[model samples]
Target: MDEETTEEIMYMTVLGCELAKPNPLRPGVNRSPSYFETLKQCCHLPIMQKEGFYRFLQLYNDSQVVVVDPESSADSIQLTKRVMYLELFKDLQVLCTQPDNVATRELGQRVAAELDVTYGEQVGVQYRKYNKTSDKTRLRFVTEGMLLQLIGDNPTMAGYSCLVLDFYEPTSNVDRLLPLLKKAIGLRCDIQVVILSTKYFEKFALYFDVPHGLTIGGTSFPVGVQHVTKVVADYCETACHTVNQIHQNESPGDILVFLATDIHVDRVVAKLRGAIPDMETFPLYGKLSKAEKAKALRSGDKSRCVITTNFAESSITVEGIVYVVGFNSIGTFNFLDPAKEEVYLRGIKDVNAMNLIDEVGIITPAGKVAATLPIDLTWYNAFNEAIKLGCLSELIDIAALASVKNPIFLRPHKTQHAADSPHGQFTAPLSDHMTELNTLHAYLRTKRNMSTQELATWCNETFLSSEALEEALVLQEDLIEWCKARLGVSEISVLTPDDKDYDVKIRKAITKGFFLHAAIRDDSDQPDQYRTLKEGSHVWIHPNSALGGGDWEWVVYHKIEPTGFQYMDRCTVIEPMWLLENDYFYPLPLTKDYGGKFWLKPLRAIIDAIDSSVPHRIGG
Candidate 1:
């Protein structure tokens, strides 16, 4: 007879309810028809039938079973016969009634039992706990090392049988392990492979890429749906405080807060402790020692808040997490100068400074970017180097006007004014290089009207270097011209040939520009007894000043020079009132006597000396 005819006859016998003879090819215990009949009505196979049926029996006898399903045919007998045969040795020991639901508790139990018997009773199945109190919730298998050990111990079992890989889903690591397992199985073809999962069966089938060798059970029903709550950085901090506040007013449960970094975790814990003195706070970061982590996990505190980073996202499950908070901002550093000179330190800046600066300007000699504010000492040094290199002409131009590609432009309105101002638009008075240049320009203008000896006297009196002043004056012209072109103005200011008191005018201008440095009197009765309020120390007029010992009633305080090798601790007191009365102040003050020099007794004495020498000329 042909193969088709033989199959047809087999189907006919199956439909006729003829009992299949026990054969070695079938590989399972054969049960009586009476036991089969018991499962026929129940939709599920009876335990006795399950033990006896070839497919179910093979699940226990052999570590692996492979079920092949034939195509449906018009001859009901043939179809039924093929199905009955296939059902006897299905890969998944699915219930004879409803065969889907492959990862159910029943399936797990059968798989576990089969593994235990085949690999020895030492084999145990693990499941992760859904509830904090429940130990066995999620199912995790033994490590590959342990599995290899089992195979070694039972060498006869290794080639003769196969292990069932059953899970809800395959992780990335599982995908990598499949090919390796297949290669191992090739050594002994007697080993069979059976994969059972609720979903991703199609993916698995494609992964294996074979015909009827792969068998699938029924689909799985949805378990209790649980929603995932995302906690951001900002939310974490706010939530931590809010939860602590809530705990203070009301009862507390387990509160979980997610921070982005370990530093943040520490900060949150500290803040919680300070804010809520009564509530207990704990930190969970990856850097924690294994023992410490275990201790934290096993804390079993009823009313505690756990502050952690993303480590708690999906890893170890914690109980009673009713509330969750996440921090959105990853705190970072903000520098003033790229060269790192003077840093106005703060937490994360509004914009990433290093990226922004590198995008706009080239690095200076100090390997730093020039910005209005120096984030660090290096940045400040870079700014100065850039200025010296002429790479950065102005801070405003670099920070505010420099062309940027795909820039994040921000126009914030000043609180003092209604109009909006672009970022980095506001300029510092004395801090800017422009202020120094302007002071030089005014000094040169005053010098054009003075004789050489007079110029020398003024230069000597003000402690101003004539050669340096000359160089600065020449550079001043170039700077003024540059400023003119930049501002779109015609004509510029220049220094004259023979101008006396040019140095004094320059010193006065420097003093005027930085009047905020005014000295406070340490003792009113003592002469030349003044300490800079800014420095918070006793200081006399710097010897460099022309009026250093001229006995001024009121002096404009600029800066204090500390005792180096030559100069002692002295403050440079310039005549600020001279500039104030002369209308030299740019972005002029609302009042002529802005900081009240008469009332400023210590400053008044210095001012009096300068005014006594000259009639306090308005302008050159």
Candidate 2:
């Protein structure tokens, strides 16, 4: 054949083969070997827990059992046992607490999803609002609260053969459950208990009388650690600058930045967006919506940056993260102290406690007032605050469903019938903050006329979580039903913002709970300054609060920010007279009792003093 004819015949024979021609190699497109991508499996050498495992194994008839792994490597040790002895122990219940020491609701779901990949239906998750476990499930992950509820319902824990506490932190729920678990062990001699932690394993082992424990070395990859020689005043700016440098000069990988607070996270995210316009930025925090959190974890075409609080250090692990910027100093915030002028800042760890109060005040039936907590004053204060905020009653009611007796009277009461206090026909008086959230939930659930998309849009606009609101409504329904069944109250009412006396009632309720958290506006030295009612230290209202720039005489705050300076969070405006009404609990400044004491002036007298101290403006 002719050459042109031959070429034409070849093209006709391979018509679609033109698409298969090797394209020119684009320059600078092939990525370098990624450090994280080239990483093999997690690099922790498995250290066997023989003594602990054998003890757990022989404890088939002994309920009080303890297994400790000082390195917090007990996760793998316990899982191996579950896999090896799946026949003997039909199901193993693992309880996990987040790094921030709160009973996390998402950890169980995350762990369960990872486990299901290998174990399929054998692994399940249990939460307050949802449960994925069934009779066929052999491995279950539950939140700290769920385990307590389980103990309340099934004291013997008849369904599970073993219980393990992972990343154990001395939270109120965990501390409360330990003694109860000991009691349960005394009643039923079948289930085994294992406590795991990196810092508290030895202490817990001593507490549980487990003399033999294992210390598995922590798993870690080859990481190059660097430290700043000099401290930077503005951490957010430094963090954003470092992230931008990495994004511009480094290969494709995600960057994780650890910040002190949600405010810092938002700030860094905003700054990074402006600097690295092509990189995707996401913020992760406890209060962020689920969709927002999911954005941080989602795989995207563009390189991503995830800025989060210290909660991400242990609770979450984002994939493809090659660079990590961490801030060492954590902000410390103190909650309401039952005693005046005293604040408990740190958890008791041997001699590491700060602002330690050896003696705590509590109201006893015999009118006695001083005692110490079994765990620590910090947990005790948390319990006290919970009781005042009506959380104890809710937990008690929820526990009652499991035939568990009320656990309120176990703690010394600071106020008479704190759990039994009736506020507006309701048995339990929720804190003003919680009350507002509940009221909003109720309004959106029943009163609002909106479709699903509209509701979601409204939630996003207000920076609220639709899922959380729905969960709150379900929880409210459950509580109301329980109140009707147990308390025998014929009338039940849901307070809303539209209520005629909602503001008055809410403020009063807040005073009753947070009387010690009262702050007075004394702008003598600064334009807007607040001081604690007891200590008289200068405090500033959080910038996000509604009363931030306002000039209110007196206000009640629910929480203090965990920063160097004391910033009042969730502030609620209250009348000065309300502080006088709660004088029985905490002594508000009284002019009659003040004998030349500067900080002990009456509320009215203090307001007058503040007014006089302010410089008079001659002209507007």
- Highest TM-score against the true fold, candidate: 2
Tell me the lDDT of model 2 at 575.
71
Candidate 1 residue-wise lDDT, 409-488, digit = tens: 21111121221222123222222233334334444665997888888665444433454445333333444444454433
TM-score to true structure, per model = 0.24, 0.65
| lDDT for predicted candidate 1 compared with the true structure | 0.38
lDDT, residue 501, model 2: 61
Clashing pairs in 2: none
Candidate 1 is scored at a TM of 0.24
Worst 10 residues of 2 by lDDT: 404-413
- Supply candidate 2's per-residue lDDT for 104: 42
Residue 337 of model 1 has an lDDT of 14
Candidate RMSDs in Å, in order, are: 29.6, 17.0
Off by over 4 Å in 1: 1-175, 182-251, 257-264, 285-287, 298-302, 308-620
